[model samples]
Target: MNTLDLHAEEFRQQGFTVFRSVLPPDQVKLMRNLAEGRYRACVADPPDRDTLRGGVSLMRAFEFGTAFRDVLALEPVIQVVEALLGDDCHVISQNVLRTPTGRGIVNWHIDDALFFPFFADLNIDPKHVPVYSLNVMIALSDVPTDAFGPTQVAPGSHLSGRRPERSPDLPAGWEPVSLRAQTGDCYLVNSQTWHRGAQNETGRTRYVLTTAYGRRFISQRFYPFINYTMPPHVLSGAGSRIERLLGAHDKGPYG
Candidate 1:
């Protein structure tokens, strides 16, 4: 069987899987340069402190850049999310990470909590809230196994049903596994999985782009940066209907 078939099975069992060369190396490099240029330009101006809050606006508007729309069109990443989430699944949240060399690590955490905030008070069934169906992280640069930390995750943690609390040390049963890869590698993780960004001490910028998709019935948080002034071509292949649903500029019934 092909990689997609293998990845699909792995996702079902482990709740996540990594695909090597999901995007062509040349394309990944081009997109990375385009995105980095936009980020640098934005940072050249006074920084917006709120942008660091780990919100959708911060990730999509500032980091992903217009070229990211092209990346979203990649067959492997798109097909995997669509296969897992069903055809109507839209881009709920797109992210870009620009970790400067030698950055400190972030706390271990779960991605779904950002959407399903009431986990602590789920007087009702937790299933009612939209948990992330799939989370895709695409590496735009090489993440060496030895340096410039990549994402660390606990394999099969999605089955736990309970989110792990923050701790300086790993709990007794959990093992920290790093998701390292070269440019064009993509990691598809279930929203239920536990993961975190490892620190980058290698003196090189670590860049990655990501998108979270949910079933069609769910709402999209933030997408299609309001500051994006480019024309349709920038997001052309994303399809008008899908773009409207996934993007913020639309004013139709979904809007």
Candidate 2:
């Protein structure tokens, strides 16, 4: 079988998969430059402590640069997302996450809690519900060691049907796996997977771009329809794929 088939199978079994060098050098350079500039700016004029996540994250990156919008529409990344979430998927959030040396750990948890308000009344088991969301993470810098604060995931934990407990007190039989990859690599992660960002102990910084995608039926996590609008330039030049990913074509009947 081919790489796509392998990745699909891996995702089905492990809740995540990695594709190495999916982003070309030029694209990597562009994202890296944008992230570096933004990181410096955030350091100079920091946001509120709660919004900053202890000085480790930057949200809504697609609003900051056209390059990030392009990253969201990359064919390889979309192919995997579509394989897992179907063609009706659209991006829900885009963020650039940076872990500086000595930054503390991000506790292990699942990403589905935010959606609880929408799905709580269904009264269905999570494992039975089709996975409607996934995170596509692009590595902007090498994360080949634990010191760089690589993300740690518990394999096959999504099958548990509930969020895994904290790292040091995981349920019986589960184990954390440190995800190590080089620049330009991308990981497709199921939002249900139990994962956390390790502390950055090395002097080097760890940079990652994360784009979260979900079925069109799911409400966006970051941007609300009542007040948010896409930039005019983005609306004009974006292709159909970008348009769908941006939720331009998923309007309700009343709107």
Highest-scoring model, lDDT = 2
Predicted candidate 1 versus true structure: per-residue lDDT over 1-116, tens digit per residue:
78787777677667678888878887778877866666665666555433433321135532345456655556766776776776666767776777786663457667655444
After superposing candidate 1, which stretches have Cα over 4 Å from the reference? 47-58, 61-66, 114-131, 223-255
lDDT of 1 at 162: 64
Question: What are the per-model numbers of colliding residue pairs?
Answer: 1, 0
Q: What's the TM-score of every candidate structure?
A: 0.77, 0.85
Query: For model 2, how does the per-residue alpha-carbon lDDT over 165-229 read when each residue is reduced to its tens digit?
Result: 66534677777898898899988888888888888889987888889999877777554456766
